[model samples]
Target: MAPQSNKQWTVNGTSGFDALKFNENAPIPKLGDKDVLVRFHGASLNYRDLIIPKGQYPFPQRDGVVPASDGSGTVEEVGGQVTRFKKGDEVVTLFNQGHLGGSLNPTINETGVGGVIDGTLRQYGKFDEQGLVKKPKNLNFLEASTLSCAGLTAWNGLYGLESRALKQGDWVLTQGTGGVSIFALQFAKSAGATVIATTSSAAKAETLKKLGADHVINYKEDTNWGETARKLTPDQLGVHHVLEVGGPTTMAQSLKAIKIDGVISIIGFLGGVKGDQPTFLDCLTNICTVRGVLVGSRLMFEDMNRAVEANNIKPVVDEKVFSLEEVREAYEYMWAQKHFGKLCIRID
Candidate 1:
């Protein structure tokens, strides 16, 4: 392959709420020691991508920073000291280059892509070799792009160092069919766990069932579906784990649906971040552990890839794919909350 020119979107400012501007004449990054230059082919979108440009929480906007967090590509060049990967290796991005594992640190935020630094939505990116992971053999580039963020979030929440800790025959409550929730459902079922899912419509419920959910609850039809889900369980003691995607509103209900000493992995904020929720006393009374999750480390990404390769688990990608020119439109689509699973942008 020949040397490629870079085309990218950058945040010029934040006042208009439309902060992103594309620059086709952007300079290609030079490779440094221990660096690998990758020609990225695809990028996957997340809910965070929609909120980042509006001067919101999670991470503030930086002028001239690239916007998307997840990317996948083939290694094009390597510096003299690079050894982990050579040319032609298909690889995926890791959101945080530091904070390898075991404990949280400031480095995660400082070095985070699409947050505090330039991200991976560009046509080309030169990353340190240490920050990339080998793509799962069973997945194509578009499927592998999603693992950097949403996939790892589910994996880290379920199997991390301080994971809520699930096992075979355990019961899990998954909130929706978004990227993280869908991945959690697949992983739980793969581990021989019973999965109960909540969705807004009968059609999505049916789809969830086809994906192996044992029971699907329509939260729209039944406002008290949390209690209903608990009653459907074996002992009516509630699910052993709750993958809490809706923040406080669903969390209040998640509290009602949890077993004693159960765990809730709080991974998203779709339902509102602050509002009525389980009281501290309620958590104490039930011995329920609430664990907040960030996307996992390189180590967790590698472990999840091994499982994906061994089990042949395919990520659920939305049918629609946008090109690099439609980056803003892609974010708008994700913001509409209509996509069943992950969405991708083709950079080739």
Candidate 2:
């Protein structure tokens, strides 16, 4: 018998979480000639998901968009011309479908899932073969799902093409407990680099330490946490890398937090956009390279998977698993910023 309509969650408007809508019988995505279709098993949320719905995303947005970029699933079908994947193969979606390699361009923003294009929050997603990568061998669907955005963004920032890449005993300062920060911490630890993390309270600080942070800074208590982080490094010079997810509001501090020749990977804007900009003299004098990271490429994702499998690294997922029907609740939990790692939604 033909399958009943597929289940999915979608953004119906741009007001807020209230705009997210559920449908019991959304049509299953049809595969294109080079497309691969998958039955989604899990999806993970990033900080971007929280803002994308409010029409405040860094990129353009399309109405009635399916609202997630990170997902893992088994191949349900493949187009006749598809060759890379077969039915039943485990796979994860890429953050930017058109971004197979090289430099990201307008098409990346235009074709991005959950942004200008449809996303993977539904029961099924049809993707170009180039838009998918085999899941990490060591991870389950949920953990592997987190790779597309958070994992790749972290990998992109740390070991990506432009990165000097952390070495053993190098100091890395990750801000907050968001998905990107947590992933960066795990990857840095795996590489034998020292990690200094900043959080709001002692409890979360403990959590960061437990996750292998060498030092923890409570930014709320220490308004000058950046300088403190710099001092914690071996030579008291500054950290080798700063995962600057705080954007303009905290970039001035990130500039203050790096050693000469250090790199600051600008990942997000949790403190809101449009604040004081990083001073040119400070960056130039420090010789700091500031790069904007947007997830990663298919090749980079595949390479990171090799590392994830080799290290047996598992993504730290929030304990509260939201069902497909609880899209709003999951987003609300993320908005509260309490999730330790990634916020995952289970599809049944």
Candidate 3:
């Protein structure tokens, strides 16, 4: 039987992670015709999760709303018209609830889970049937939790543009050891592409190599790591895909590393907003495309899951585990950049 009350963590304000408030008895949402009640087994953190609580996100959030978007759970109950899911089925939340396919629009921009609506941090959540996708069978709940945001973003950056889909024997350049970069490495390798990864730490470079990065460059050691990466390619022609996560600061280097007509998928701005940036003329001279990625759609999530299951791709979660009650600590850990891959919060 479903419980009458839901336990959840609510955003207190812009004060910080410590201001997050835990509630023991929030009302269980009344199911609509197409709604399903999910009992979350696990949840994962993202950069947006850290920034939203601190009022750094650009989107407007509902006051004291439940926080977090990446989650995997079981369907405990379903409404009469809920067709996509049923009791006992395991599912993962979609980061953008309204975007099932095609391109993103203004309306879709307002439909993001964690920032624009009540998200998956609660013990129980009522979601529309279309808002959930079947969890990849090969992954555990914790591993599957990481797929909703970072995994999908990586997949979109690589496969969303059909004309430039990653092909076998292609070259891919990944930046740092963040969740998106790590997933890009794994996906590119699975597709038979050679990957060149950049990291400041030698320890992380070694980890990248183990993850099948064909070559690892220590960015700290080589200030012009992008040129170094380009030189590693055949005849210095450069790479086919560059996962551009380090926004303004790294754009100049990415421009140097990309091959003519190659795709540079801009995913994040971890390199700080005010850094030496590339100009329009630089992009014009590079003869490459700079595409911005905003996570991905529900259809993309489904497609990525199938590929993940077929390839037996397991998401790299951090060795440290946090219970639901330790969500604040999880945020702090992510802020410190101590985790190599995805950080998880196990819902007990």
Candidate 2 vs candidate 3: the TM-score winner is 3
Candidate 2: which stretches are off by over 4 Å? 161-163
lDDT of 3 by residue, 248-296 (tens): 9998889899999999999999977995788888879999988999999
How high is each candidate's TM-score?
Answer: 0.96, 0.96, 0.98
Question: Whose lDDT is higher: candidate 2's or candidate 3's?
Answer: 3
Candidate numbers sorted by lDDT from highest down:
3, 2, 1
lDDT of 1 at 246: 92
> Each prediction's Cα lDDT score?
0.85, 0.87, 0.91
Put down candidate 2 lDDT per residue, 1-348, tens digits, no spaces: 334578888887778888898898899877788998888999999888888878788687788889999899999888999999998899999988888887888767677878766787888888888899999889999999899999999988888745487788788889999899999999999999999999998989898989999899888999898888888876789988889898888988788889888989989888887867767677787788888888778888888899899999999999989988888899998898767889999986
Give the Cα error of residue 51 in candidate 1, in Å: 0.6
Q: Residue 20 lDDT in model 3?
A: 83
Best by TM-score: 3
- CA lDDT, candidate 2, residue 165: 79
